[model samples]
Target: MDFLNKLKDITTFVFDVDGVLTDGSVFVSEETGEQTRAFNIKDGYALQLAVKLGYNVCAISGSRSKSAIHRLNSLGITEVFIGARDKTEKFKVYLEERHLKATNVLYMGDDIPDLGVIQMAGLPVCPADAAEEIKAVCEYVSPIPGGRGCARDVIEKVLKVQGKWMNAEAYSW
Candidate 1:
């Protein structure tokens, strides 16, 4: 499928946290109760672009981390789900609450937990570092690795396809 054509079906964007947002690393300091995670600046910029383009952005994860919340909040993202073991079920609920159809969503994931949601969405995306099984089923795979601008690349592809990239000013920062 052509990359741009896929964007016509997307209205919502869903992301996985661990591998998709962070580098799949957990840094925990027992002494200081501090945890740190690395995020891709390009990915953040892409998300800002999606928001400016009027797409609903959300993050879904089975892990609950304060760091995740802080990072997403800083980006002006409000739809976040933590500790969600059944992502597909949660996604259904999210669709119902938002009054959106399954065919209007784009889901990006890198692991097994993400499989269900990816299968259900209209457009399924995976990062370069995604597992082989995930890559096989995804509609698109980014050239960039996860947590290293993969998300941004996918967002840019979508925007470009939808003919909305030129109007997205939020990414100017």
Candidate 2:
């Protein structure tokens, strides 16, 4: 199948948090021992828009950073899974709960941990700086690196192909 055809069938967006959402950099506060991650505003916009447009958006991560979870929640992604020890299992549960097929899901992951889930997705993608092993399996690799609009790049493409991007809903938020 063609790339556009794959995008057309995608009803859900599953992304890995650390390297996929942030730059894979963690800032640990020496005083409080708190770890935080940075997210791209453009990516946030795309995520919220996907939610508003009725697409299922989820974030899964092996990292247990509260700040990362908080950031994803703030963007209206309620299906956030932090501290996922077995991402493949989590992905299966998410699919079963939602009654969704793997062929209709877009999974973007950035590392070894995400390999299992990424392989199950219909359209697997990764950021430019993703591990070489990860890049090898992905059907699409964003030119933009992690935490630098990579999420936006894929989301925008899918939305645009589905005739959902830049509509009246996009103007407001």
Candidate 3:
């Protein structure tokens, strides 16, 4: 309920890829030398739901991968930014491009690389298994861990508060 109030005004969600989206472990294909990441299907669904509800969802990560791009694109997220070293700067650019204010942003991250952007966001969030430093700065730490349903936890809270969760329109498929 507390988190719901904090997320009530959020219009955008920015996420860090490594520890927040994945389990912070990369599965490198020895045969093809391609990096693979495991993502949560529930998280993916929530992302699409956010987009369907007209909220901007973005991905900013230092590592780049083709599969990640394809996955996010499949969910209709066009603001995916992989190979991003300066997430805060990238986030600022996104805000300017969309004519949005920093105060309307929610950022979820889980490590040192994500600290700057997490601080810049109005509502900073982290997964349950996030680093101690990262968790310390978060406004809310999801009960679920990364690569699980962490994103779903937060998104559902916000949507439910706004009377969107479980609504017929929200479940439109």
The TM-scores, one per candidate, come to 0.92, 0.98, 0.95
Over the full model, what C-alpha lDDT does candidate 3 score relative to the true structure?
0.86
TM-score winner among the candidates?
Answer: 2
Backbone clashes in model 1, listed as residue pairs: none
Give the TM-score (vs. native) of candidate 3: 0.95
Error of 3 at 120 (Å): 0.8
Q: Which residue ranges in model 2 land beyond 4 Å of their true spot?
A: none
Judging by lDDT, tell me the better candidate of 1 and 3.
3
Q: Order the candidates by TM-score, highest first.
A: 2, 3, 1
How high is the lDDT of residue 157 in model 3? 79
The number of clashing residue pairs in model 1 is: 0
Model 1 / residue 95 / CA error / Å: 0.6
List runs of model 3 lying over 4 Å from the truth: none
lDDT of each: 0.85, 0.93, 0.86
lDDT of 3 by residue, 37-90 (tens): 999999988988998888889999888877789888888888889888888788
lDDT of 1 by residue, 83-114 (tens): 89899999999999999987878889998889
- Residue 63 miss distance in model 1 (angstroms): 0.7
Clashes of each: 0, 0, 0
